[model samples]
Target: MTATAPHFEAPPVRAPRRSVQALLEARFAALLVAPAMAVIALVAFYPLGHALWLSLWKINLRFANTPWVFVGLGNYVDAITDDARWLNALRVTLTITFTSLLAEFVLGMIFALVMNQSFKGRALVRASVLIPWSLTTVVSARMWQVIYHASYGVFNRILVDIGLIDAYKPWIISPVFTIWAMIGADVWKTTPFVALLLTAGMQLIPGELYEAAAIDGATAWDRFWRITFPLLRPTMLVALLFRMIDVFRMLDLPFVLTGGGPGQATETLSLYTYRVIFTDLKFGGGSALAVLTFLMILGSAFIFIRVLGAPVAGAESER
Candidate 1:
């Protein structure tokens, strides 16, 4: 009698209104994005699909009489195995990519940090720093060419004055200096873009974090390492991802500066592909190279996206 059983009622099944609402909202969002997706497919996917399809064939536009021969994977095999020029171009591409990226990131970070401080002329400094990045690749490349000119280039003159070298040497020629010259120019122009991204990222960080760190007896270096750097990780990853792709597929700079010349010493993958397609009129081989370049870019992007942490919220959740 003291332990009387309490009666419990079974839960009633509802109309699932919340789930229905969520489903409807999702559908609405998808509908809103449909147009953009369609445009991207039309512009991006169509060309990529066409290039992939074209790569499987042997189509030499030079010989109009010969039919488009289907040599599936043959072009890829040649590029991977038999092509010496392709290998050299790939090497040059990677060398510039890594070297320029490192220089840009380090210098960009320094610039960003300097620009972030509360100092006189900060606004003017920031704007001026972006001038290099704002210039078109062609303009920047031509400008650098003038600076690197053999006889009267400013760079050679400066080096001679500084006694860095005995005499003004060829900056855009001589395989040893050609690639490096391009890298130097690229880093100078691109570092500003990286700095801009980082500065924007820094602005998003809450001032309270810095204030709290200061109260807790953290030095500037300690705060940067423990707070600012961690917070800026996403921005840095984004900057690097953009730069890696741009550097890997670079064409205009090398083409404009050195014409990928002096015996193809600085020929990038894009330059070589351009020569193959437009110069030699080998559409199939050119398309194969394009496809390979796209794949490499995709793979690198995938790795960066992975390291950046998918869902993006995952990084926030970890903290």
Candidate 2:
């Protein structure tokens, strides 16, 4: 009741917001990602854009021409209908892609199944499998070239010993056998990769599922179909896609082994483009071929993802 002068109450003070620190953290994150973006734009996008632009021009390496005359879609037309070479190259490309993919898938699946079992020396076997895959493409091609030689080749010696052939023959020089030689080399080199991927997928499958299937008196084949196949689909698709893309762009093996020779039996789109750019000096036509090859890859990827329900690496990573 003393009625002392009411003490003036001080207004509550709010804490200052740390807006500057938040902004600095965001800036740091952006700075970290900027280098990757720059690298992608420079290495991937720049060449793609240049290739597309060059495809529209009528530029020949042999002729002296400046400003590269724009021929609109003439180059594309030449590549598609006007040239029989492109068609032949396309056929070879598809043949290699499908055939090699099929072989790799079957062999890789078998290898993966074997590796998935508990066995002795499994680590050694896995290490051995990677040796061929680790060899350089050029080295593999040269080694296979030697093996396919008409004289003093291990393959011919083995075939002769086994009574498979009457005499040694030049495998790479024959048009009929050139494609098969290329396919064999490719399969040998790449099947290990497929096995590795499939093995990884196999590891993801729960062992309990197999145990449960066994308790139900399911056979090995039944367990594989019902339990393993579904889980392995994603990885199998990934391996198939990678092999298909590589086969489509394949060049070094066929180039070195057969030189796309014996009348173009093994010539693929990549080899065709190389011939156009280097041998024929048709830069515009080569650029058009490059663009078309890129489109084919892109279109195939889109179709596989859309129709086949394949899981892309990016999508899988996001999940």
Candidate 3:
């Protein structure tokens, strides 16, 4: 070998101190969140994943002895293209969701404005308004069922007294009326929730802004349109999203009120899935329906996020 200079390795380049601390902090933050992430994955995602897995098989609990038959996406395809019940339920679900959402938005906005004003008995009004929302859904649904009762219902009694109808017609039994009744009940029960949300948003706004608007000669209508509504958009979107999700998966009211009856006129997607799984004992089909419903809800959340430019009520500033 010819004579050669001693080979030497270059000294290791050290990272900047601040960058090293940042990286370590990021790792520590991730470590802190890992337990909560694990809990969420275990609690929330496990059932969803299990449902997805079950949806791919033909698992008829009635015949548990038979091995699960893998049908890939057949169940989903059947629900989409073949099942008439599923189609009808989807239509009913959309109708209720849209109509109730519209009505609730309007009424809720009005109630929120009124509650935001400085007036006597304001605290009492807020409490009274929240009572409907605070009651359990099952209790509210049962209360509505009694109110729409065919024989002794207050609705029919009032209508008869006013002579709107010649006799006490069964509003809950008639196909057309049954759907409308459910929509009305849902709007009544949930509008307060929307109002509550909007009221909270309204409170966050500085009252001095309103005073300044008044000094600038902005009419009440103009102020509402310009100042109130602009700031309330995030909250409005949140309430809309929450109500949409709840109505999309509605079960108690329909179950207690119509039981998806009147010749399946009011069968919602939730009720349909329940019957498919429990009543029909077709867990696979039900799982597919459930998964489809979850996807729809997830898609709706994205639509809200994109359309409103908000991740939630408070994330608009982040955007």
- Which candidate has the top score in TM-score? 2
Point out the worst 10-residue segment of candidate 3 by lDDT: 1-10
Residue-level lDDT for 262 in candidate 2 = 84
Q: What TM-score would candidate 3 get against the native?
A: 0.87
Name the TM-score of candidate 2: 0.90
List, residue by residue over 114-202, the lDDT tens digit for candidate 3. 99889999989988998998888888888988898999999999998988998887888998799999899989989999999999999
Q: lDDT of all predictions, in order shown?
A: 0.90, 0.89, 0.90
Model 2 per-residue lDDT at 212: 94
Two-way lDDT contest, 1 vs 2, winner: 1
TM per candidate:
0.87, 0.90, 0.87
Q: Model 2, which residues run further than 4 Å from truth?
A: 1-26
Candidate 3 — which pairs collide? none
Tens digits of per-residue lDDT for model 2, 169-231? 788888788898889999999999999999999999999999999999999999999989998
